[model samples]
Target: MNFRIFKYLIPGMAVILMTGACSGNGANGVNGNAASGSSGPNSQAPAGKEVKISFWHIYNTGPMKELYDKLIDEFEEAHPNIKVDHAGYGIFDLGDKLATALAGGTGPDLAMDGIDGGQLKIKAGTIVNLQPYIERDGVDTNQYFPLLIDIMKQEGNGDLYRLPLETDVRVLFYNKEAFREVGLDPEKPPTTWEELESYSDKLTKWNDKTKLLDRIGFAPNLGNFWYWTLAWTNGVDFFDDQGNPTLDTPENIEAAEWWVKMQNKYGTKAFSAFQSQSGSLGFDPFVGGKVAMEVSTNNLVSEIKANQPDLEYGIAPIPIKKNNATWSAGFSLEIVNNKDQAKADAAWELLKFLTSTEIQKRHHIAGNALVGNRLAATDPEFMKDPDWKTVTDQMQFTRFLETPIEAQGWGGQMWKNVQAAVAGSMTPEQAIKTSQKETEDLIANYKKTS
Candidate 1:
């Protein structure tokens, strides 16, 4: 694969200065000690010196936090020479904190970050190029989903800088009870966009006196809803192979128009008022039976179990148009560029241990996450959960939104423009055209500095 470099911006943040450490092993190699002369489960760290690497992640509470602790303890026991100093941060704060720390030369040796943040770090030179380390250790990139691996590569040149740990897939989830209540077959969920709209119309309820929505059949912009995913199902992508914005495509415009029609059908004022009621009451529209169907990620299953255990729900691959497609996002583990050869090697060892099939399997079970490692994700034992199985089965048809190197903060921008269109403030075509120009200017500015 050709690795290409594209420019993009990190929304709500500024480009900070980043520094790369010189490697003793030359441009294409990482600075690290030779591998331990053992194989399989008995791999050992180079004999004498003990190296400690700091690890930071946003999984700070509950089951996920416990799982991280267990994994770190086991890894430390196995590689006695390496000690991990682990810290947890809230997801919202971690990105800014890491940026500030890296800028001041006090960043952790390794971190678990979202793909977008990892990309920003890669561009900033705050993270180490992991290709050399992968080569030196004979790491098998083939063990991962090709699409997952592809996302980690630098835009212009395929230098891998992050290793994905876990990921999630988007699917359409329906309240089976709601379906039955509407006289629709609970077993047969909507398979096409037209069916989705028809079923939604039947399921939706209105208070004749108040003229407000009592229940919504579906909302295009609800949980895990991504416009790009809709476009993808119609064979449209936001960026071309060369990383230029392609939001103005006919398919994309159609997708945008579809959402606007949904808004108009429900009446934007009534829809917004209904959403406000849910928010005020701390109610989940889907779980509270206010929404018949929702486009959501797998985590919604666990959430439903926790908040409304008796709610019967069914998941299906998202409704398709001309093509079958879904969107996915995940967190990746990355080694930071700290100018320390020994620590970099230590971090590499830890990365391998964490991403190993067995460890990945255990982690997935403990934290209830979709494993990024292909073997663990496909393992029969892990795939036993019907909900999880539904998600994993869609992996082949799932793709990440194309965030060009230049459109780093495109997600927020796209959301804003789409919302404007849905609210009738801008036509679908105008919204997309505005997005394309804004994205182009963002790229241009990024190029000027870069």
Candidate 2:
């Protein structure tokens, strides 16, 4: 599993308030729980024979772990004869262990991992194609975001390989109090790059005598925001139509330069020193009123609520440069190919219950997350919340990053290059050019083997 998945999947502290609300029918118009007699191949445990399936996942702690345990207890009660042997591990450890187990033909029947890792397993033939089971159960794939479900389909054969668990979009989080303090209207936030720069200037504070920044109005590389997000906003794709890396294109170079400019305005050394202090402060700078604005996902709500519930803030669409765009990414659940037909069926049942409309709604409300199931997100009960409305409304401009398989580990390398540019070790053009060459070489090596 990716480290990013760990951040997104952990439920907020608010979830503890909704622990009683997990049971409900699926969005597909069927009961999501096996105890409700939902029609499916594994809806009921095999007659006169007990069946067991193993489930492993990265949600090892926090409210999410507790929520899953509660759901599992209900599942076992509903299907008296079917047993689930489930365990949790550190995300990286889980990925390593899962790979080793699959190689040894002893992997669990069901597991959860980052979408890319799941895709790799699918290509390797260790993960099961879920299309047949989806068809058998009449699951309404239409209920999911088209982009999300589309990505799950195999490139050539269109076989669905994994199911998305949660989806999220980036948003601009501004401290309303900071806005008031800076003489900017609390209701008006920056909508374009120009405005963001101007607003940030006013919102930033400096310790005049020390010639150091007291606070940053906006930090381009901070929080969950990624450099690729700016590339997309500027209408540049990481790759060309030929599936080759295009990181150093004119458009991308411009975007990287803009990001570098923002860092330079604060003086790299002074900014780096301030950032180190902020980290030692042991809380999100936004929640601590140290940053006037931040680009982050809805999950930041959890941090605010947990640390300083009284902080007033506003959420808005990300400021645009060349286009109105943001990226969505999330963790997904996958079923491993099991030789025992009964175990396979049982794994599907567990998956169905987790994604059902009722459970998905609970997930959204409890965790402040955007679920893959559109029905769950748009429910009348959840739609009433303004924060949910803000995030979901931006879904129209949201898109998934479509990295080609040949460039599987490209992001880590790209991040290092981007960091070098931000820290002033290299020029933006130099960093992007170096990344472009490295990524192209990666694709070439993959082609030689594949």
Candidate 3:
């Protein structure tokens, strides 16, 4: 789980709260007993057969873990015949494990994919398609977030292979104090890129004698591909269906160029020491109060509140370009495709239970994670917070990373060069040409083999 749980909130954020996560065999779920079918209105377990299913997931820490454990209990309770055994795994490394397991014919019945997963992008090809199961169960996909259901369905008339468990979206956050100091209305976050640049210029602060940065205009490189966001906002596609690298498109270049300009025009030699001896990414200057505005995600909310409760932040839709498009990402519950129909059927039931509307609502109300199911996002209590609503609303403008398979084989090598150019080593023209050619060659080889 990429989630971090805090039991306690920052003063008013929660009346009684806890910060650490549940570990060991600890789960703060409902009653200790295993629930049987017909015990509740949502039961899906058939009358017979005690099936065992293994699940490997990423959320073992924080409040999200608590929420996940509870959902597991709920699933097991509803299907008294199936016992779900879950193992915790790291987000970054799970991909390798999953690939090995699937290829070797020994993978968990349920597994969580890496951070970039959307419904249609299950490239590892281990998950069972859920179309037949959903139809048989008469599941009303409309009862959940509509696109989540749509995205989880395969692009070309196939079954739903993944169920969205949760989602996080990026938003524009500006510091009210910084806005006040610069004679701008703190309530009005800039609504466009042109306004953002003009406003950012005004927000930059400097010292006379030292000529050091007192505060920055806006933080760039929050250790994320926020550049992708800028590229996205400016309308850059990583590739088209024909597998051509489009990052060199005029809009993408415009976006990346603006970022380069921001770095040169804004502060002094920043501590390029972000990559330290320990190999940890640089400290987040955003949290340290050096940044006045940023494109950020809900994933950082806990840390921000912990460090600076009175930081006076306002969230807005990310500023737009030709039109609006926000990059959204999150975790999903996927069932491994198996030749053993009995085991897969057992596991699919578990996934459906965990991602059901009732359980998803519990996750949202837990105050730790947001529900990815569309129906849960509309829960009246869920949207009470205007900020969360902003994050969820971006779902309206979401873009899934629809990278092609041939590109997938060498995307890392390509992105390494991507990082190089974005870091100023190579020109965008060079980066795109090299990466695109590599992908084309990879696809050609794949075709030759076929």
lDDT of each: 0.75, 0.73, 0.61
lDDT of 1 by residue, 1-450 (tens): 232443222333323212122112122223421221212121334445898899998879888889889889998898898899998998657766776676666778888766533444554455677766677678898887777887667431477777878888889999999899979999999998899999999999999999999989998877777777787888887777677778888888888888788767887689889989877646467978788999988878767866789999999999988888987777778887666667877888888888989988887777667778988887898677777788888888987655555556776687689889987789998888888889888888878886
Per-residue error for 14 in candidate 3, Å, reads 36
Count clashing residue pairs in model 3.
Answer: 16
**Cα lDDT of model 2 by residue, 352-421, tens digit:** 8888888988777667778888889888887888877888888888866555556655666677887898
The TM-scores, one per candidate, come to 0.87, 0.87, 0.78
> CA lDDT of 426 in candidate 1?
96
Better of 2 and 3 by TM-score: 2
Give the poorly placed runs of model 1, Cα more than 4 Å off.
1-44, 116-120, 154-156, 280-283, 443-450
Q: Comparing 2 and 3 by lDDT, which wins?
A: 2
In terms of TM-score, which candidate is stronger, 1 or 3? 1
Worst 10 residues of 2 by lDDT: 1-10
